[model samples]
Target: MHRKTIVDVGTDHGLLAIGLALTGKFQKVIGVDVSQQALENGALSLLSQIESRRKGIDPQKAALDVPVEFRHGDGLKALEEGEADIVCMAGMGVSTLLQILEQDHDALTSDLNRRQYTDLILQPTNSKPRNLMFLYKSLQDSGWELRNERIVKLSSRWYVTSHFTRPQSNIPVTALIEDGAMKIPGSTLDCTLSDSDPMRQDLEEYCRHHSQWIRKDSEYGRMDLLEEVWLERFGNDR
Candidate 1:
């Protein structure tokens, strides 16, 4: 746990922000959403959780005193530069996430470059391979390196969660981007993944489950990522 301020983008219920606040890992947590209704609902839920979690404790040292704030706005537009140390956007489709990044590139890139916000956590709610790859490429091209990535199963569903950082962090690479699909130079997807790469297996599994979207779609990059990963991991070589 680190002493940092985290802004949870698209925080529908504010559960993640609240849970993190309870851990004492973060000093403050701000939840931002476009829908005022979601923010109100999340605020009510936070109040309920605070009331239930704070019995027999001094009002000054409550368990839920994590300084969680809720703001209504569209994505990063809700905050000023250097306002937060980290930004977490969960439960969004890759396409939707990409759109937000595209629209918020000015703010996002500025904060990341200034090292005001070091970590960006993106978890696409859906399992669309092409959209994920496109997002990966877009971020890489924009200078954010994928520092950590995980594929986890939750209640019979598998999702990919990625942690990106500016190159200033100097962290060793855990996820390798090899193998070209749409020519995003300097991308994690620029070369072929080696057997030692950790993401190989997860990419294979993701591709296997996403076979249903094999149909062509040019705007979305079609099945290029899916087929490439399939061929690289489970294809003729295997």
Candidate 2:
């Protein structure tokens, strides 16, 4: 979450990567997309942005300090383990998001796991609840930790965004909340949203709306698994 190198996966037009580079928040920004044309366009856009900032300047050679690259590949295949401090996936389908995260295991070299520094920032464009549930379950199962979640409404549609990091046993989930420290039986995890989390109201509404969809056979029932998961991850009795 702090200053670090960034890998923008599923990058469309590379706008976000470019923007971050312009802000100088990251030391490097690598934009990855499945489409070659998209990467080309993004590169051009990045160049144009730089040129616009300094007229009659060579954007590529300009002393912007931050290095930017565009790569063509599916999911995280374009990146090596520990190559990035933060991996961002935005405006992607739930299935694709899941697939990308699943593929991430391939990049977990020993050094990367040891540092536990790589972070994931995901924004799914569809299947919000299902995606949240999948992500929650996946994190718990894979020993990754959910650091934050928020809902954002744009153009009358809401998108759920989450941040995660490789598991750290030191930060118990119960430590995040003021009075919600009911211990999970099998794990020592605790999680809570900030009072100013953008979608706090919407999240509560979602948990209430999906209350009807709880199926007995479902792993987490009809409730938003995000809520069920906090308990499941750090609450369940072993």
Candidate 3:
């Protein structure tokens, strides 16, 4: 795996940061948290782990390693400009993630090369499906384009990772948006297939799921728009 600079936000115990550093996945890891005591305790724990590892290896065989830093501050507040390439915000809620984005939006937009910041890996707790949509939309509006997504099943809940990049103007139109969403003007569709065919099966499947969710009065109103799009695309097919 390629080495990358990693910043893990809300790093409580610093295990992930230490693990990444030990595995050589990252040259350096900065664990950021708002609580001073948490940072102090986490740093102590991380240092102990690093020392334990060093004791097992002969000095001649040991590789020089970068020390992990623990910073006490709000999300990205203590981080210097262009300090890291990957930002991992885990063990936080969607609302907290949005708040972080709002607070750091200007700094992130101005200092970082949006194209080079390869990923925003969020593992949000207490997130509704629509909150995910809202997050996706907000990133799009901020000039970041999602590149990949994955849903991992954890012991109790699902964790999602969304990797993004700054959109290139020359990329195909449909590649810029979500599967069931609309594209912005001047975006070119990447597919050679007819437009009608792209959403034919999607509409049918969405309707089936929407009807089920609607019957239960789920709080996700975006499903209504999905159902509407499905109906508009395949009215008589049902």
Best by TM-score: 1
Evaluation by TM-score, superior candidate among 1 and 3: 1
Off by over 4 Å in 3: 1-3, 60-67, 105-118, 167-215, 218-238
Tens digit of per-residue lDDT, candidate 1, span 15-50? 887777777788888888899987677764775667
Q: Tell how far residue 89 is off in model 3, in angstroms.
A: 0.8
User: How do all models score by TM-score?
Assistant: 0.72, 0.68, 0.67
Q: What are the Cα lDDT values of the candidates?
A: 0.65, 0.61, 0.59
Instruction: Give the Cα-based TM-score of candidate 3 against the true structure.
Output: 0.67
lDDT of 2 by residue, 37-118 (tens): 8777776577566756665455455645546777899866777766778878888886777677666555333333643447
Q: Which segments of model 1 are wrong by more than 4 Å?
A: 56-60, 105-115, 167-222, 225-230, 233-238
Clashes of each: 4, 7, 1
Please give the distance, in angstroms, between residue 153's alpha carbon in candidate 2 and its true position after superposition: 1.4
- Quote the RMSD, in angstroms, for model 3: 7.4
Assess the local accuracy of residue 105 in candidate 3 as a C-alpha lDDT between 0 and 100. Answer: 58
- Candidate 1 lDDT (Cα, 0 to 1): 0.65
